[model samples]
Target: MAILSASDRDAAAYPIQSLFVPFPLVCFTLALATDIAFWQSGNVMWQNFSAWLLFAGLVFGALAIVAGLMDLLRPRTRPLRPPFLSSLLYLVILSLALANSLVHAGDGWTAVIPYGLALSAVTFFLCLVAAAVSARKYARLAWRI
Candidate 1:
């Protein structure tokens, strides 16, 4: 009988568990990038793209949160992964940002756009940090086990 390596075992158990957080992280990054481009070019298409990105980020972020929560609730998962808390925070921040963006976009309120962009940027950084931390934790745990 062949024995599975610790890393292999961990991978088998977790499968795509870690991939969940990256979805929102990437989405937010793209959203921020699109927003910046739109601001620079002052193009209607880029503005529309930025808005779409924000909405898409919200959808993906919500899904990522659900997936992360499910992973956290699993019996074999780590109970104290930093990504879990960070992801939760990311969700809240992104939701607020999305709301602000929607209102601003709908009413052509310029003031809300800055605030929304700022909030989204903060959440984007948080998601990046969380994803890195979570990956590191999983790697360490897998190596140990």
Candidate 2:
């Protein structure tokens, strides 16, 4: 058997998009937590943290979308519509996250005190839906084999 080093390996075999899946989940989840904390304590610091988390989530989520697109468009792979749709859903979540982050960019506690929290809540709900759909799609694929 021949062994391939990391650099020598085919990129498609690595599932780069899957590697990125947890980042936005963690970031967005933490953002929600921080928003709650900011509300409870009236601390500006938590609001600031939530904003940064949204920013990071959006950045990583974009990278993940690119990787997912590459995977979806791979030359020989079967046309997997569910996963493709799941990616589209993630893109929507990413867009919402970007908007929510901008909302947080306003000055002081007013930035994230009300509207930001609401937006974040909706974005996080979409994330859960996306994750669930993707899981279902993966399970279907696994069962087919």
Best by lDDT: 2
True lDDT of residue 129, candidate 1: 67
Quality of model 2 by C-alpha lDDT: 0.81
Poorest 10 consecutive residues by lDDT, candidate 1? 103-112
Cα lDDT computed for each candidate against the true fold: 0.62, 0.81
**Candidate 2 lDDT, 1-145, residue by residue in tens:** 9887754454235465777878998899889999989989989999889989998998888888787777677643333434667777888888888888999999887898789899888888988998899889778766885
Candidate 1 global CA lDDT score: 0.62
Clashing pairs in 2: none
- Model 2: residues with Cα > 4 Å off, grouped in runs: 2-14, 76-82
Model 1 C-alpha lDDT per residue in residues 37-129, reported as the tens digit of each score: 656665556556657766776777667666766776765555434555655666576666577456437533253257656765776777666
In the predicted model 1, the residue pairs found to clash are none
Give the Å shift of residue 145 in candidate 1.
10
